[model samples]
Target: MMLHTALNWRYATKRMNGRRVPDATLERILDAAHLAPSSYGLQPYSIVVVDTPELRERCQPAMYHQPQVVEGSHLLVFATWESIGNAEVDQLMALIAEERGVEPASLESYRHTIAETVARLSTPEARHQWAARQAYLAMGMVLTAAAMERVDATPMEGFDPAALDEVLGLPERGLRSAVVVTLGYRDLETDWLAGLKKVRWPRDRVIVRAE
Candidate 1:
């Protein structure tokens, strides 16, 4: 019920009042993104939290003049890895081993699964598309987390990925911008959609009953 209320209270906020989301709240929201599930436990994405005024200014034009890019306290650029390779999988496995206090080789099954992912996503196009889907999952988690924290967030896809990568210097890190989520407080009076009802298809229509 609380989640429902939170979801109902939220929207793709069109205008933010440029108020900063509290640091603690921002941490929780980001943790939710980190904890979001990903394919093959790779979690092959990076979130660039843009809090600097200069960077936000640079980002606005990249987002095609979207006000949220500049108005929000923080802009999360969900960029996924250009490609997942054996080296990447090995890094993740090593981290997992360190966290669990076990040898990386002990997780053979998991390694195999990730190896399969590397093989399947051999092509650049395949890897980019797969990485983007994982990036979307991260964004969805951030949206729900922000709603629960009573912070405003706007998930945006209408942006020049190439331009964003350039602005953020992501290409050098072997990442490409997949999507963005701007975090801030909504402008109560100015946001036109703030007063509108949340519209969606009926639950019965969307939810299939297999049984």
Candidate 2:
């Protein structure tokens, strides 16, 4: 019920008051996203934290002059790898082994199975599409976390990915910008949507029982 209230409290804030998010609150929100589940536990996306005013200035044009891009306290750019290569898979394998206190070789069979299946889509276009989807999962986690923190966040997709990539120097890292979210406090006095009620489909219409 508390979660539901939080969800209701959240809205796509169109304007922010340019207040910085407290470090502790920001950390908890980020931790919630880090704990989000990803495909094969690979966690292929990297969240780029942008808080500098100068950096946000550069990002403004890339985001098509969205006020939130410059007004928000922080901008989170969720960038995903272009593709999952052997080196990438190996890194995850090593981490998993260390985290689970097991030999890396123990995960060899599972690793190969994933590679053989996903390697077919190793092409740039295919991987971008696949990686972008996983990024959305993290986005969902971010939204929920933001709500829990009583912070305002706007899930944004209105931007040029190629332009943002160039600005962020993502191509050098073999990463491409997928999605973004802005975090801050909404302008209560000026925001028109502040007093409106949230509307959604009823549960019976959206939730179907397979049985």
**What are the per-model numbers of colliding residue pairs?**
0, 0
- lDDT at position 201, candidate 1: 98
lDDT of 1 by residue, 34-93 (tens): 999998778888998999879999988889998887788999989888868988888888
**Candidate 2 per-residue C-alpha lDDT over 75-160 given as tens digits, one digit per residue, 9 for 90 to 100:** 99999887677888888888889999999999999899777756877688887778788889988988999998899999999999
- Evaluate model 2: give its TM-score: 0.95
- lDDT of every model, 2 decimals: 0.90, 0.88
Worst ten-residue run, lDDT, model 2?
Answer: 113-122
Clashing pairs in 2: none
What is candidate 2's local distance difference test score? 0.88
Which candidate leads the pack in lDDT? 1
Model 2, which residues run further than 4 Å from truth? none
